[model samples]
Target: MKSALYLFLLLLALQVQGQHGSKLNAQQQEQKSPHSPEDQSQAEGENSPHIKTAPSNYDFAFRFYKHVREEVGNSNIFFSPLSISTAFAMLSLGARSNTLDQLHKGLAFNLTELEEQEIHEGFQRVLQLVNDPHREVQLSMGNALFIDDRLKLLQKFLDDVTNFYYSEAISSNFQNSPEAIKEINNYIETKTHSKIAGLLKSLDPETVMVLVNYIFFKGYWEKPFNNLSTRDDDFFLDAKNSVKVKMMHQSKPFNIHRDEKISCWVVEIPYKGNAVALFVLPDEGTMKQVEDALLKETVSNWMHSFTKRKIHLDLPKFSISGSYDVKSLFEKMGVTDVFSDHADLSGMAENALLKVSKAIHKAMVDVSENGTEAAAATVMEAVPMSAEFPPPPFIRFNRPILMIIVDKVTQSILFIGKIVNPAAEED
Candidate 1:
């Protein structure tokens, strides 16, 4: 869900349009409410014209995802779209500059300006990553003050997402006044390719919030099991009863790497796009040591230090979904407000009455012969995390484990998950 006030205001903002870097020609086009957020901004600094994001957008997004990977203990998780978008939006706010400027810092704008070829290549890279055959994955571009430019896709993405969420608040079915909720839900159902947003009904709907959903998957072995080879295998889950699971086996020599702290390998499965799933199996009896050693620096270093090797591989075809409340996440990431009525979305509309209310995210993923598949959706908790607890552990696996799904070109996470029980398919 979105902040009730921001949602309503953005709805009006979309219907009421204007060219980039220009006024809305308040005469006959759109009606203006005196108490509206936009109205207040007009009275205050009407001279300041321009929508701004922040310089730290990319770092914020990447760091947040990194946090999720390292902090969340539950296996098989999908990243939420709405949550990531909101993170960008919030990051933009603290950027102290325009969204593009913030993005420049991330994409190395200063180093290699945005050229037409770069845009084409960037989109191509993104598309290739999303359309990879091995793992089902998705990538979205969003923006702010969307006018044709180098960052149009990014801005449009956010604009599209804003409209998507605003529709939810005005739509979902509720007790006495469900008309608005119904209207919005029906409209959104048709927009997101009928993939998500079943209905817009929740406990609280008047504050800042976000909703996220996703899908993910890593493909089966190039040579699938004959059912005979997939006999009950003893999966070391704790010291208790060893769960029986069908194990997929492979003997192809692939890229394998290991150190005193960690073990990793890449297995390529023949598919439409250059598809491959990389697994990082921590050394036996050192799962805790590996996790404890985690840091953005270490992960970045590991990714940069890749070498191919030949080794037998054993993995399992599996799928999973993961969900989390991002209130605390935002707090940890240093984003407050949007949660409180004090939230100032005055740039979009009037009155300082708006507040971020609730956030919920859910993601789904699957892996099989047909190619890997995944989808994710996130809803921001206009408020903050309800519980005051530290984030839980990520995972502790001794045997083979799934690590991440990457769009080799852009190196973005289309889907990130782990399967503790390949057969169970639990989140």
Candidate 2:
């Protein structure tokens, strides 16, 4: 039997309006509180090894975001950095020499500070944490290696991915591009519960192996907005242009902070479980300032500075997806050797020279009054809210906004992107 490990993240909210009837239960509310004693101890303790690599992952997240932003321009942006990182990490198992070093560096890992073993162990810990069955959220992550039946992979490489990364290896005939593409896409769709489909439009016939990583997350807001409050509003694209969108409204107490340095309002909206969504609304013309300041320390400060306040929040009811051929992007990030003929993937298989030919990534997110539903997949072919006090600030996401979803347990960022226009579907 092929065991299905569902690994993805989604945020879902239902239609409601002008009512507090959908408030979180006691347990959910407790999970929303920041800096809990247990959370603090876990961060300072040895139990949470994934914390060590979080900084690296975040660094990669921001860098990748900048690259994608530059490529897509002002279009709506959404992609799972976690899925991308995980796929590359699994690929690193087969990487050697400069190829391996480039992978580590591109992932923003400091070899001097953390050993290679520690890095893999950290990811292992993260996989365990997110897949915890008892957690209220439905979140899962998985990896798969579809290898050409003609090539023989190293036993050690196979063992490492299975034991450390929870990956499954299946024999594939890449020469049959259509069948291979169909099989891989079907597997990903099933894993993400159909949130992501046709992740690979086509596969290279010369491709000896294709590595894939996927994540599916579904989380409901602790405080859902009432559907009655949703109405048409303008979402400004810039100083000159705007688009009409169905804006969801809610007024309630929320964890909010103002970062004067970046000139943005950071609001933390809790999900019904260990995840939380962060909406960063930059003041007019300061979007670039806030984006440039995206760093581990910057986000940490925002999380620590949050204060409960009642405010009226107006957010767009939007759904967006982003797809990219990350081969060029990875090269720009200094991961060149892996894609070139000078590659050293000898650790993967004996007597065969292997290199990643193409790497693709796709992600989708749906946000409504109910919550959020998001799913993402990566194939290496090779590869908010509100609230108020004193009439509380009426913060409306009527312009470009940044969104970040995080898992409190591991402090791992599940997804991050910008919504320049709610009406745009893809970039």
Candidate 3:
């Protein structure tokens, strides 16, 4: 019931947040763009089960996120207690369809009562709003959920939250590094459509080394699947059930790894920035059955002891691209109390009092035998991740806020970051 309520609120938020679910722009609707029952994009085949509310799939994704968050040292110092408690509340309230409205009320209450210095400074204490441990942690979780199909909406949310804290907390130190400033600026525009503008001072570009980390995966398949032999095959859902799916097939030499303890295979595909998709297909015959039987113990044993072999490989030549507001996404994962102001945030900055502003994420994955292409980017620092103030004092950030990231070793940023902050930045 709670899950259903969350889904409803999600749909409602989409509508209220300007997602018309139509290609027709707002201005176009005013002019009354022609509407036809059939659409050109629909000239394709049936819509498959891609975005269904599957618990296992969702859990897997979030687990991957949690693991990454924990991997980023002192993860506990990221959010203040207030934010932690608020996150808890959000999780509980998410079960209710009217949760979004309630969250607004709760956030307003916190903003009025709490106080913070840097919002998230140096990542230290858990005493006040500005430096609260849990609050910043919740905010930093945004580190992952930044990719989104709707980059504009994602930018708006990003801008709102960053401005919330940095409005007064942030300081300027351009002498840190000029090349760093240029690097950061270039990356911001490239990643976020030029909406984000300033994230560093020329003086301290090396600061990036302090707060940044990266992951690059690349791979090549030993056996390539042939397009000619590829056909729609019956993929068993359960030993007793099955569904017909387009499965690519080919006979070639592949370093196929298998494990008897946990039946599966290791297939890899490399991409531009050393990114790769390592697929593990189970031999349980039925996908649903295999998934149901999956456990960490089995997975570990498979990864540790799987034997390599040469055999014919069958796969699906397909792509799945998706994006979501991860802030709300994690709310469903049971961390609700952190968004509140009545909480603590003394760890990140000089003062205490802070909350998450947004959490945006996007991903695209394509697979085949000869090779595969896949990319995943997530940013959840905020969804509705902003600290509300009465009309916000002086919007010194008249110019677009920028974010850039580069691998000094590679002289390139495989990924860039951004936050729109305001509608004005859209220009």
Candidate 4:
């Protein structure tokens, strides 16, 4: 269960807001807090030779992705299911009875197969592994609970969140002070490296607690694209429409596979560590078919089929950002009780009638010849093949294509989205 939440946190790739240059030095990196008992236990679990993940875990992730895709429509879509689910998991920590059951079912957790304790433990282990300072992946997760000072929260709930999720607790005057809104937004901005702004516009007069989760990831490609080769090129939006884009060119060996069943080409580009960006390009008009057939099994098969091959790749340099209110999305997924008056969050406070009033998410990603510079925060050169050999197969992402940044070892998707028109001015 905890593994799922860790995967939930991995969905940090949603398009947030601003575009910033990632230029921080290693010395300037923020240090994690001292380890607790939870962290130690998580470490022990993570050191195992093989990582075990239940199939339902990926099913839950892909199901959530499908819902987001449907809601966002055909335009360019970017969201971190990990970010959304992490928030829900934290909320579920304080939920009880029917409310708890609804959250588990909505998030696609198999209640009969996994107990509650196991779920939380899985999350702890994943979090600890991802937050390891020694890892080369540039990733960080932050959670904050803004509560109305008038209502005293349960101490045990606060402690559990602190120990298990490493969330920061803050007290605020939601009803009296409008500054609470600013404070909350400011905190989110800092945590997300200013990628997301105005996360909380206002607060309800009776809002007992507001929970927020923010994750930022930045990594450079193991083999970077040559910046000099980047030039203006046409990106086909459709059969008759196209836009000029700054396409980055490279000719090198990449982990690629051709799926005849879906008529699509799948490729994996490794990052500095266990993370990688998987790009799926469908044949001409077969994008819809590929999307419809998307599943954990499909991705697993692609991974297994991947073989190092020489190819000339031309990918456009693009940056995308998006905002969403996922309350309706969750409602459509049959998670309505948590937002309605009947919400049972009594475990959070005594004699409470608590329910989530808002569910907001924002994400952004930028891909260039250098690598990636998103909300989190760059350079590499691909070695060209020998001139004596015949020209390698060229793969130009001239149209809409699916992209996912995943942790290769755990096979958890951190961010998933599509670049319909990389050069399109609008999101």
Among all candidates shown, the one with the greatest lDDT: 2
TM-scores for all predictions: 0.55, 0.87, 0.35, 0.85
Question: Between prediction 1 and prediction 4, which has the larger TM-score?
Answer: 4
Top candidate by TM-score = 2
Total clashing pairs for each candidate: 65, 30, 101, 15
- Model 1 lDDT, residue 184, Cα: 43
Each model's lDDT comes to 0.38, 0.77, 0.28, 0.71
Q: Write the per-residue lDDT of candidate 3 for residues 1-427, one digit (tens) a residue.
A: 0000001011000000111222333333354313211121123223211111112222342243343333432111011112222222222221222333344333322323222222121111111122222110111111111211211222333342343322111122333456544654444334333323353333322121211111111212222334445566654333454445456654333333444444444443222212223345544443324334444344334345544333445554433322344456445554343333332322222222333333333322223433211210121122254555432221111111111121111112122111111111111
**Against the true structure, what is every candidate's RMSD?**
17.6, 8.6, 24.1, 6.1
Models ranked on lDDT: 2, 4, 1, 3
Better by lDDT, candidate 4 or 1: 4
Model 2 scores worst on lDDT over the 10 consecutive residues at: 374-383
Worst 10 residues of 4 by lDDT: 1-10
Model 1, residue 393: C-alpha shift (Å) = 30
lDDT of 4 at 307: 91
